[model samples]
Target: MNLSRPLLAAAAALLTLSLAACGSSKATAPGGATAEVTVRIPDPGNSGVLALGKKDGSLDRALAAVHAKVAWTGSAGPFAPAAQELNAGQLDFALGSITSAVTALATKPSFKLFAATDPDPVGEGILVKDGSPITSIQDLVGKKVAVNQGGTGEYLLLQALAKNGIAADQVQRVYLRPDQSAPVFSSGQVDAWATWSSYAVAALADSGAHFLATGPALGSDNYSVWAVRTVFADQHPDITKALYQYLHDGDVRAKADPAAFLNVFTDAGPLAVNGRSKQISVDFGRQNGVLSPIDDTVAARFDKVAAFYAAQKITKSQVDVRPDLLDITKLPGGSR
Candidate 1:
């Protein structure tokens, strides 16, 4: 579902204030140097990256180092709105799926990717009703499938269907918000739901949906990243570096003790899955001081995503994912 105009306008206004906050003297660098930066976090899921940032104080720590302010905002749709805010100079940075980041860069070349969060983007997966007759991906033919259109959820489902020789035209596609899809799945309106971690896991727990396919199975990189406006980066390079360093450190700490990360999830409210944190993977690594990119297998998964989107005619033009969009080397400790 598309976000209402009022919601979009409010987000835009909040973004403007956030940008203005960054421009104030509070965001200046050490020794009284002038620098302002604000990071806008889009709501993903209960245990997603944004939740992790809140739990571990990653944003606070990162902004503290740069003396910048963090304005966390809830998003209703995909990265399009957030990307628009960034392009309008209303935001300094955003955290979202790799596909979202790619879309942002494809349309607006002024942004640059700084870090990868999950190490493997292809790790995302899809779920179907448990104890149902739909055991294999091929069974999805002619079935009603729910997904968040133009987002990672949609991309993952498309990739899974293509891999199983199931054509998109053969199935009934239902596009809904992540929250809206959850209830519909619970009510048994949809045959299956394609989603990402935490939300997908939670939906399965609530609706008895079993894992049908994961990002890796469908050739996805299963990763997310941080993207920032180039102008913001150029004006506040030190803050950008410090933000990456702080987030990398938080990831390291979270991996060392996954349970500690759960506190953030608990504060946010009940997770999608009850007591399923133990079954989920929360490992994060840092190279040098910045978040690391996905390994070869993971990168291959992203390649498949680009191909699937192209095949579906999601975009009018070919997506050239190179140094311009997925630049992993530019991060402070990215080379490692």
Candidate 2:
């Protein structure tokens, strides 16, 4: 994650040149300045609103106001690894849940929160086989529960345990990636699995695993969040602001017409959820997908979550994410 000054400069120059080469020189600014600029953003397998904007060219058009265009880059893995990409200067922007963001920040990664989704505790929880006798959160006391280390899965499990007045050490935490956890849980290697988003929906549909306890029922406040490379935000505040507004608009469109948003596609296929998991996906996004700019309220919520993670030893220590939040209104170009 460390880069010498010359190498960092070279990387930045290369990125600028690549963007300039792909941007449309014909685009103009109010002052007659050339608007040939492109901003690199991650296009992960399930891009959600990003796919809608990219497919409709709405994102590009939106960025045009800042004399910028979109440059979609393929990305992979969970938010923890994505944070590495941001720190390494491999991506300009990426999205993740607040749990993942806090975990990554605890390790001192170089990224900042720009926007966040309203926390929807639905679809996130611990799941067990439909007929399994482990019916309540208390039943998890001695059972093995699969969780993504220091990520959403772990956060959900710990939160549920705390809410039920159970200590985390009481349960056997089986840390695994989402893909890995799925098979293990299906094979009954783990007593339960704690997860969120499409993974949870797919698990219920494909494996018939019913929720032992859901986020809402457990009073969880896990949020869907977005992040930008710290250097990238500082260097291109205008593009950063434009990208945030574009995402907010796309979120609005998704909530307004879930079906249309689901229809958008990238090389991997449908942008949002479709097929058997469609309705649940729609419900989840509708109930929890509203985007809000990072403000005092949001910052305070994140601080609380960080403290919880630290208290439970899920994080090495509490991560103060307030310093990492980007206040777009305070930036020169961002004010517009």
Best by lDDT: 2
Q: What does candidate 2's lDDT look like per residue over 304-331, in tens digits?
A: 8899999998777889888788886665
Q: What are the per-residue Cα lDDT tens digits for candidate 1 across 1-336?
A: 899999999999999988766533244468877554566555544553346776667667656666666776665345667778778777667766767655555574667666775524423577788787888888888898888777777777777877778778898879987778888887879888888754664564456776787666777654676777777766555666766676677667655665555545554455433354335433321121235654555455456556656778776565665554434345333110
The lDDT of each candidate is 0.64, 0.78
Tell how far residue 26 is off in model 1, in angstroms: 11
- Best-matching candidate per TM-score: 2
Off by over 4 Å in 2: 1-35, 44-47, 266-275, 332-336
* Model 2: worst 10 consecutive residues (lDDT sum): 20-29
Supply candidate 2's per-residue lDDT for 28. Answer: 56
TM-score, candidate number 1 = 0.74
